[model samples]
Target: MNQENRAGQWSRARQVASPNQDARPHGEVSLLLLHAISLPPGQFSGDAIEALFTNRLDPNEHPFFAEIDHLRVSAHLLIRRDGECIQFVDSDQRAWHAGRSYWWDSALNAWRSKLNDFSVGIELEGDDCTPFTKAQYTSLVDAVGWLMARYPALTPQRITSHAKVAPLRKTDPGPAFDWAYFRQRLSQAAFKQ
Candidate 1:
C-alpha cells in the first residue's frame, strides 16, 4: 500500500487541492462516509464534479449548477467510474462532506454529531439508479485498504454511507451501491472488519 506523506496526501491519487476544506478537529479521523454524485443529475465523465469541488463551477452552464454553485462542499477523494482516484483534500484534513450529520460512536458509547470533524468522505461518480462500475469498486477497495492502514480508528465498522449519517438531508451512495459486494471485496483484499 502507498503511504501518505506528512502533508497528508496519498501517494497514489492525483492531487487536486480543494479550498472547501479545513484542518481536522483534534486531528481526529475515525469515520469513512461514502457518497454518490453525477453532474447533470445522472451524466458522468465530465469536469463538472471537479469544477464544483474546486469552486470553479460556472453557474450558467446548467440549471442544476446555478442552484448549487454557491454551496461550498468537497470530499477527501473522488473515485471515478473507471477507477481513477482524484484527491481533492488531503487524507489528514477535514473535507466538508458530511453536513449536519450524526454517527453512533461505539467506542465512546454515544452518538457523535458534526461528523465532518472526524470523518473522511469518498464520493463515487454515480447516481441512485446506475450500478457502480467494477473498476470503481476495485479502486475503492484499494483506497479504503490504504486508509484503514493509516488510521487505526478507521475500522470496517466505522465505514458507512452518507445516507446513514444524514438521513434527513442526503441519500447518496444509494441503492445502486452494493454494500454486500463491496464488503466481500474489502475482505478479499485482506481488510479485516
Candidate 2:
C-alpha cells in the first residue's frame, strides 16, 4: 500500500463515499477511534455494513437491521475480515461515528467532548466477542502509520477505542481486541516510516 494520504483519502482504501459526513467545525484531526461492527451482530462478510453506512440498508432484510437502519452513522474507514480497507469519509471531513462521546487529550490536559469533531474513526469487521484477524491488524497498522505521519497532531497515545470514548453507550473494539499487539505493530510500522 502507498504510505501517503492525499486529499484526506488513503490510496490503499476503496473509496465509497457516504452522505453521513460533513465539514469539521474546526478542521481538527487528532484522535484515532477504533470500533468493531458486524452486520447481524456476529455474522461477517456482507453488504449490510456498507448499506447501513450509505443509508441504503433495507430494514426488512433483517429484524436487527430494522431497529438500526434509521440511524445515520459512518466511519472514516472500515477494515474487512480479509483485510480489505474501505473509505466511507474523507479524513478532512467529520464522519458520524462517535455519538455522545468524550476523551482525555493529554496534549490539551483536559477532557474533550464530542470526539467526532477531531477524530478519525476506523471500523474493524468483527464483533465484541470475536478476535480480529492478523490481516486486519496489519492493515490497521499500515493505515494508522500513514495517518500519524500525515497528521502531525495524532500520536500513539491519542489512539483510543470507541468503548472508552462512549463507555455507557458503546462497547466495541472490545475485550477481544488485542491493544498490545496493535500497538506493537503500529510502533514497528511507524519506525519503518
Candidate 3:
C-alpha cells in the first residue's frame, strides 16, 4: 500500500497507528517512557523512517536506516520535527520500545522490575546530537497533556528518559532535550489546557 494509505489506516484526533501493535498487558499504565529518533540520526522526518517501521525501508536508499533496515520496532507515539504526533500503539497496549530497563525508587533501593509493563512510550524525531525544535517541545507537551488526562495513573514523576533505564545501551531524549523547559511547559500547559 501507499504511504498515505498506511498513514490513514490509524488516524485519530490525537494519534495515528502503525498496524504494528497489539494489546497492552492487564494493568494500569503508570509509567511514561521518553525516547528520541531520526532515520539517519540527525535528519528530520521523512517517509524512509516511517517505511522502516512498517517493514518497507529500502536497504540501499540511505546508509543511516540501511544498517538496521531489517529490524522492526515501534512506539506508542512519535512526535515529529514540527511537533506532529503519530501513534503506532494504543494507550491500553504495550509498545515494544523498552527492552530490559528499570526505574529508580531510591526509597526502596531496588529497581522497579516492570517499567515497560504499564508504560506509554513516546519517541521524538531527533537524535542525541540534534537539538529538538521548539515546536516539537510544544507538541510533545500537548501530547503528554492529552495522555495524562486520558490515563490518571500517569504523573509528572512517572515520565522518564530511555537513558535512565538503559544507560549503556541508549542515550535518547538526550542532553539537548531540555528537560526543564519541557517540565515547565507541561506544567503550564496542563493548567491552561
TM-score of each: 0.96, 0.96, 0.85
| lDDT by residue for model 1 (86-180), tens | 99999888999999998989899999999999999999999999999999999999899888878899988999999998899888999999999
Preferred candidate (TM-score higher): 2 or 3 = 2
CA deviation > 4 Å runs, candidate 1: 1-3, 191-193
- For 11-124, candidate 3 gives per-residue lDDT tens digits of 432454566566666757778989998877677867765776567888888886668876777788888887777777666776678877878765457678656577888888
Who wins the TM-score comparison? Answer: 2
Number of backbone collisions per candidate: 0, 0, 2
Model 1, C-alpha of 81: deviation from truth (Å): 0.6
Report the candidate with higher lDDT, 2 versus 3: 2
Spell out the clash pairs found in candidate 2. none
Give the higher-TM-score candidate: 1 or 3. 1
Q: What is each predicted model's overall lDDT from 0 to 1?
A: 0.92, 0.93, 0.76
State, as a TM-score between 0 and 1, how close model 2 is to the true structure.
0.96
Clashing pairs in 3: 24-93, 24-94
lDDT for 63 in candidate 3 is 81
